[model samples]
Target: MNILFYNDSQDQLFHISPRQRRVALAVALIMAFLTLAALFFAGTKLPVMSAFFPVLGAWGVMGDVLTSFILFNQFRSSRIFPLLLLACTFLLTGILSLFYLLSLTGMLPLSGLFASGSQTAVWLWCFWHSCFPLGILLFMGSLHFNKKIIDRRLLPRYLFSGTTAVLLIGVLLLALATAGQDKLPVLIEDGNYRRLIETAVGPAIWALCALASVCSVFPYKKRGVLRVWLSVAVFAFLLGVTLSLAAGERYTLGWYGARIDSLIASTVVLLSIISEVNKLFVRLRRQHEELEESQQALESANEQLKELSGIDSLTRIANRRKFDEVLKQELNAPQRAKEHLSLLMIDIDFFKAYNDHYGHLGGDMVLRSVAPRLEAEALAHFGFTARYGGEEFAIILPGHSELEAEQIAELMLESVRSLAIPHQYSDVSDQITISIGGCTLRPGEKSNAHDFIGRADEALYRAKHEGRARFVFANSARDSCLHPFETTSH
Candidate 1:
């Protein structure tokens, strides 16, 4: 039922659409221009060759195209889109690497120079250097959007743990790559060997990033600021690695310049992915919260309904329905143990005539007053009481003998008499009074609840017939009999 998904931090940054795509394109274009201008200016000022610029521009454009495709696809579907995008991206990278290798070894003459042994080294340096700033930008952008993308998927806990581990490894790898580049002279001779070593750094870092991307497919229940922080960490590590490799010194003048441009384009693409991820995470979180709230509401409603179903609306006591249930439970145990069980049926005397005189409202007040007295007295001697019907109430006394039940009935009569409520048109005395009929099931009495109730009803009839405001005990003998008496009428 819930439609909105959000993260713990309440950040809603990732939502890729045509508008975002346009923005990304605009940013990519701007970065591309900046990279080109930097390359041209550097070439004019420094003794950098012009031939490598074209190759650098080509790689930059290709990287931008591939990244755009991947970013757009991710918004459409997480299940197949990311995988397809990654596959296409990896293929493009591989092709670019092959082309670069060909250009370096003199088999390809795109630059119009037999790539001198030095030229190949220079090309590697140029490629990474150009890519450095762009990679950092892309990584930052991805970090910004990681939350959205994470929200879109049900990532597993282990995947998040693995991502953290991979992110850590990426950080270490970046550090190592930077150290290697900084100590380029000691690590390798300043030629093609150094360039090859630098190239290895990018692929190694990319492998770590790829692992992280794959892990995103698994469910990770992480939320809030933690997701943001994790994303930032991964992006930073990747950015550091990319920049380290791209900013190295041992490249051909033209080749070095071109790599810088390509790096900028790649960076933009990665940033797009991050933005998408963030939006997805936000949506997921909102949905989760809504679902939890709905479930709680449903449970509370069910509990209330259960309570309402068991309670009597009139007197706020357990109704006849509840009485039946309680009786069944008590009877089962008492019957098994052959224990004595007593039932008292009490009714307001002359209730019909009282209603005729004072109206239903006054009668209701009288009933409410009389009902609680019966309940209190029953609970004092017996165990439970219930409003059995209009103007009628019942109490269950477990393990009570016939004599004990009669005593309890007497107590109920006394309690009702103490209320001092007036009843003018009664056939009994001048005050409000009640008639109670009680019957006790002796040990080994093999009858259902109906028989016990029938006997109590008979005794109540006898109490009313003799006079109101008295207690009547139903005889357990075969013949219908009752010892009834009036205690106090007023």
Candidate 2:
């Protein structure tokens, strides 16, 4: 779902479908034909053609600005060297285009902004076009010789310093050119010949762009779509340069043709970036949805795990750990002070002797059998049951008084006796039996939950001491009860 298309293992915009390639080629050919036709037809008429050149120049500037923004966004995310250079080049192209446009229309505040004198605009035009090729050459060099220069931490400083230096140098050169404009010959005048500076600089800039375009073709074993497109843009730019020289004067047919070619070059890069951004947005949305679903599934799993950790595996009841947690809550809970709460600690009488006679498996079976009976008595009276340990269980009655707890304990005793499980080695009786001890108190009476459990344990010990198959109630003198059972049916 990560739609960030790049050249390595990632999805790249360079891999175009056959239909898309065809469409692109058609558009390129159309633009080239239109440019050539316009240049040839407009050559004879200067006044009509001059008015449209400014508009085309402005369109070129806007396209360069947009392409620069797209590249900058890519650079911010990837911090790649080539993207940075391309972004900077596009930005410079935009600024230079604006100056060229303003100077051609006589709107520039300073005469030196875009020209030295008669050919000042032409010199600025050469510098503006040269920046792109220079940036591409640097990008190529970074790919091969300076691979480590793409450090994210240093990129901002490099961009700022480089941009500032470029601006400063441009300003200084324009000023110097303006001061020397008077001495420079008018190359476009009726009889004035072109000077060496004008003759040499323009062709040299065009040559650099051509050389860079050629260099771009062999960066890797196979050429990528991006490289091919870059070369195409450079070639188109070179064509525009040739058209400008052929026009030999401002506002001529060749001037309009050159501006149109520049506009087309900027548009090509802009269109590709737009397509890439659209794909990226779709991918980001899909990843976000997938992340939300995973979060919900993880939350459900955690809840199940929490429930399992508090349960007893063998008896299928709340375990000792759960019992301790509930007891602590009840003892400290403020609402418990308004009602009676009782703790019943029950133990299987002579369970050790029963295990010796019946084996560990039999002991486990007995524990399981007794657990449900305890739970039934506790639940029937609005209480909770838990297995405190082997052959022992605890019950919590939240709103029950001492008398009600005693009755429930007696019912539990009868429920277990009804099972009639055999125990020949038991000293008490031939049938299985249990001893119950209970304590009832308001939660505020005890300082801690463990103190309450300690008092209940004392009562259970007393029940065992007196005799098995009996119930002992311990809380206050008014609530104390020691109910013993007589010998029953064998």
lDDT winner: 2
Judged by whole-model lDDT over C-alpha atoms, candidate 1 comes out at 0.55
Tens-digit lDDT track of model 2 for 364-441 = 999989999899888889788999998889999988887778878878888998888998887777889898888888
Cα-based TM-score, every candidate: 0.35, 0.54
User: Tens-digit lDDT track for model 1 on 1-490?
Assistant: 0111243322222422455445544644554455445443332324455456556545654654565355334433442222323323333342434344454444543332232233443343334332333333343344345434434444444234433543453334333333333444332344323343455654654556545533432233332222232233233334333433444433443335445534553444355455556667888899999999988996896577547657777787778988887777677774636778888888888889999999999999987888888888777875678889899998999888887777777777767878888888887657787888878777877667788789889988887777657767787442222222332321
* Segments in model 2 whose C-alpha atoms lie over 4 Å from true places: 1-23, 35-42, 46-51, 110-116, 182-186, 190-200, 219-225, 283-490
Global lDDT of each model? 0.55, 0.71
Quote model 2's TM-score.
0.54
